[model samples]
Target: MRKLDKNLTETLRKTKYFLLDLDGTLYLENKPIGDMKNTLKFLRDKGKKLIYLTNNSSKGAHTYVEKLKNIGFYEEGDLVYSSGVATIEYLNRYYKGKSVCLLGTESYRQEMINGGINVVDGDRADVAVLSYDTELSYEKLCNFVRAIHFGATYIATHPDVNCPAEDVYLPDAGSFIKMIETALGYTPKVVIGKPNNIMGENLKAKFSENDDFSFMMVGDRLYTDIAFGKNCNFPTMLVLSGETTEDMIPSAEKQPDFILESFNDVKNYF
Candidate 1:
């Protein structure tokens, strides 16, 4: 494990919430990164709250929860939060009772419903939300573009153009956003996930009462995870278990508060 600065130790000890990124941080393609389960157990045993955060909106929290449980990374008090849930909260706050045309999976649509959003299916929607729709259909894609062109408010779940994989990267919501923008000649008015302050604001609103509790964002991505933590004014830790490497640190626009060889290294400090 690389030796982290003394401030990192103080930060880790004081953090009340650990906002963890699943892919490329804790695990990759369904496998945990070197003894990560024990690392998470160490954090939990220290009375820290765990919140698994992801920008992929293709599947709802339940899907991620099940996956985490199967991989032995989840416990009763741990929470799974995706960009879809953040988007749902964003919609209910700003466009309450408005008809939304969501380009997401059926499970994500149900999450919208559960969050009190009036999910619709036509191009006449009052708001148009685009997510990483694993079940995306060409018809739905065209309709979303048309709806945005028809003057519906455009919103995106996140700006991740590609999702990392063991083999090749998969096109995420940002890729679809590019396609939609090509058709409409415009972009989303708001994006509600990592690297955006909306998600941070929502998290702050829900988790912390009066800025007493502190959050620590640990992830593998510079533009998303570390950037989100920086944008949210939270301590950030970049793990090298994913897409980023030691060489990438100097070039990262949003630098992390600390760098760890992997999530497993975190246990060493404890």
Candidate 2:
């Protein structure tokens, strides 16, 4: 795999669409990389379509848009596809207005509401949806477990264990899933996010079929980002500015098509 540098410009020039990871690949914590806005503008100026693809289901698409705007990467009509949005889409298609018991943040709840799904209280729900909740507590866990034990359909937005932060990684929806599994003796029936068919279908619907399209997946995590690319037959680039560290390379289950220290470093290759 080649390191991202100025020589990769030809490759970038050839790309027609960019599916970007929000947390690690675009920003670290709440801070955007120095050249991030410019890089996005550069891609757009070259006629490439851009979409923000994030596994953090705690927030909705509009929330992501606001966050990006706050960080100065303002773009109109830019699509923000979160795992939460995908989960909503999945439920709408399959369950069709079923009562759901959700274990997620306020934003997630709002997204479910906006998506026309019903969020009910207690174990009587037809389905139990799990997403990243920053305010996760024992009480909420108890309620979710009860719902799961009562045979409610289990669904997870993503299987991300932890989310990258400026100082430390925060437990994601997958971590809570593990806890519930250990206690209930079962895992979620479905996980809709990166590396899943649901996300692929959503993306494919947005971009028309292209036999000659060269796709690339760029992100920081090996499991989610790189695995998604590898599973979907797209080239992957892993940046070291987020979760994957130098020492973890040998043990990585999936390898990236390219590796770079950061997005800026990759610019040199382009």
Candidate 3:
């Protein structure tokens, strides 16, 4: 593993946009990591643009904004972006206000509604958006199967199987998606989240004109967060705070540009 160094600070100082992960890199179990708020303030004070990159489609961007605000991160609306937002954007572009049925949390439904798309409760939808709904039920699965069988377009917010918390890992929306896929005999038409270009494209568009811009994706997951950055040809920082650990380094097919214990240690690189 590559250690954090002063050279990393120079590289970060040159970065115009900082793509950050929420769950593992900045917080754990709804609590901000040590010095995370201070670090964010420091970046903002330096006039560096920061965007919260998350694969957790269980909640919308507004929900995240509220959560962050409650936790003492005073961010404006544009600073937060979620997979839920990406899904809405995709649906709006292709379907153009089609009647959609969503198997997601309340926050996801709200996001769909905010995007001016109708959210049908049953299988009568024109398209079905599968997101991470922690309150998933067998009845909902039955409805999702029916919708897919009826030729409604199938979409997933993200393909994450599990999400890490402070206590233990929990079943993410992708696990439920697999169940529906097994019954339907095929996967969704598209998944809008990390390791995909949709989120990256949104980030790039938000921070346009990047002549001197460098990006570093800081997260704890190898497959999702790190892969997203590497796939986009951006530098990656793997912090040992949540899902990833030191022992898992050798098995990883892709490596990060730097590795630190947590966000607190990242300040040293600055």
TM-score of 3: 0.90
Sort every candidate by TM-score, greatest first: 1, 3, 2
The sequence of per-residue lDDT tens digits that candidate 2 reaches over residues 1-270 is 343355356666666656778777888777886688887886677677777888988777888888889998759857788889989988988999799999988878988998999999877788999889887878888888788888889999999888777688788888988988887687999999987757766666557645323556788888888888777766677888877898987788888867877765654554
| Error at 104, model 1, angstroms | 1.2
Best by lDDT: 1
Clash pairs detected, candidate 3:
none
Which candidate ranks first by TM-score, i.e. highest? 1
Distance (Å) between predicted and true CA of 169, model 3?
Answer: 2.3
* TM-score head-to-head 1 vs 3, winner: 1
lDDT of each: 0.88, 0.79, 0.81
Q: Residue by residue across 137-246, what tens digits does model 3's lDDT show?
A: 88887888788888888999999988877678888878877877776576888889997767877677656845323677888888888888888777788889877989
Model 3 superposed RMSD (Cα): 2.4
Window of ten residues with lowest summed lDDT in model 1: 207-216
Model 3 misplaced regions, further than 4 Å: 1-7, 209-213
Cα error, candidate 3, residue 36 (Å): 1.6
User: Which pairs of residues collide in model 2?
Assistant: 5-268, 5-269, 5-270, 6-268, 6-269, 7-269, 8-269, 8-270, 9-270
Q: Residue 166: error of model 2 in Å?
A: 3.9
